[model samples]
Target: MVKTIITLLMMIILFLGGTLFGIDQASEGIIQTRGYATADVKEAVQPSRDEAGNVEVELLGKDLQQVTFEEKEQEFQEIESSNFTQKLAGSMEKGVSSFYNLMIQSVYQLVQVFF
Candidate 1:
């Protein structure tokens, strides 16, 4: 029993260590990618001071785009009126309920047969 317990404890520790190492590597990669992205963005947006000592920034890759408040509000209104999410949620709930009932019935029948 002690040997089994020791083996299980060692397995758990190894599993936890591997999980932590994987998470650390994943996070390090994400941080490095984000750093590169930030560097690229910084290089794209060049900042300079004019003769008047006023700071000016220019985006090199693409033209600056602006979205009006009315456009955003219209989008929000359209999303609210769609009702697609509500319908999808209702369908999913019905499916889950049906599956639950089927599972329960199957289990009950199995128990009756065994008993």
Candidate 2:
């Protein structure tokens, strides 16, 4: 019947569309993947106050810290107890989360065809 044909067509179209465009569903959700991701870096100027009472921002034009990842998953409590890399990563988490949220939202809006 026409209904069955339409259903089959939709299924085929969605399957093809998913293969071409819906990698997000095929992969883990954005939030979950974000947990495994390393933080993005931006060159920035951070203020440093000298002993002689001069305060000025120094430009750090390089990636301030490189991510030295160990395969072990770092936990909140462990970050405080562990070495420099863990602490630095914990500190960067907030900014990275915000950045990811903004980027994903923007892309979602741009790609949304249902509206």
Candidate 3:
């Protein structure tokens, strides 16, 4: 009986080890495929700093340009204004919950009035 238990335990350990190794390999393959899909494997270039240690960002490329703080704020506001789906979803959730609460309250009030 002891020998049988030992053999069974060894088989269980081997099976678990193989399962974990397969899982690791599968996850590695997924990560590699994701990296390939993004095509952004190169290391990112760090922003150059000035003598006073102030962070200086140099925007390269033709389409990029440095904007004022007001411009950035306006851009953020525009993005927020354009997010209609998020606002709609939030309002729908609120309406559904409010309706559910109203139904429960009406039931409770009816029971109190009757009994």
Candidate 4:
């Protein structure tokens, strides 16, 4: 029983761990959740005095406009870009969940057998 649980946890961790790479918008693009745009920058609450210490959030323009308030947003009319790497990476990255899920299911079956 202990071995099964340990094995299950190990499988879950290994499945989630990996080098994820790809071209994603450096910021959320206009097409992302249209109604919620976040700020472009902010003060980092963390204690790191690195280069551009300021924190920048990636959000789509429409979302940004909506966030800042539409009346104020209308003044800008429009913004643009296609710098999303994570989304593109998501498209290109291989789906590895199934194999691990199968392993877990197999364990479940084996555990059931023992019971």
Candidate No. with top lDDT: 1
Model 3: runs farther than 4 Å from truth?
1-8, 23-72, 108-115
Error of 1 at 23 (Å): 0.7
Estimate every model's Cα lDDT from 0 to 1.
0.84, 0.69, 0.81, 0.55
Candidate order by lDDT, decreasing, is: 1, 3, 2, 4
Which regions in candidate 1 have their CA more than 4 angstroms from the true location?
36-115
How far is 56's C-alpha from truth in model 1 (Å)? 18
TM-score of 2: 0.23
Error of model 3, residue 17, in angstroms: 2.3
List of clashing residue pairs for candidate 1: none
Top-TM-score structure, candidate number: 3
Model 4 compared with the native: what TM-score? 0.23
lDDT of 2 by residue, 4-83 (tens): 99999999999998886768564556647656432553436676666776665657653233222553345554765768
Residue 68 in model 3: shift from native, Å?
Answer: 7.9
TM-score of every candidate relative to the true structure: 0.36, 0.23, 0.43, 0.23
Task: Determine which window of 10 residues in candidate 3 has minimal summed lDDT.
Answer: 57-66
Please report how far candidate 3 places residue 43 from its true position, in Å.
4.9
Query: For residues 1-115, what per-residue lDDT tens digits would candidate 4 score against the true structure?
Result: 9999999999877766632211235235553655455564333332323355543343432221113468556655443234367657775554556667888999999999999
Residue-wise lDDT of candidate 3 within 1-115, one digit each (tens)? 9999999999999999999999999988987876753365543434665676666554442233346799999999999999999999999999999999999999999999999
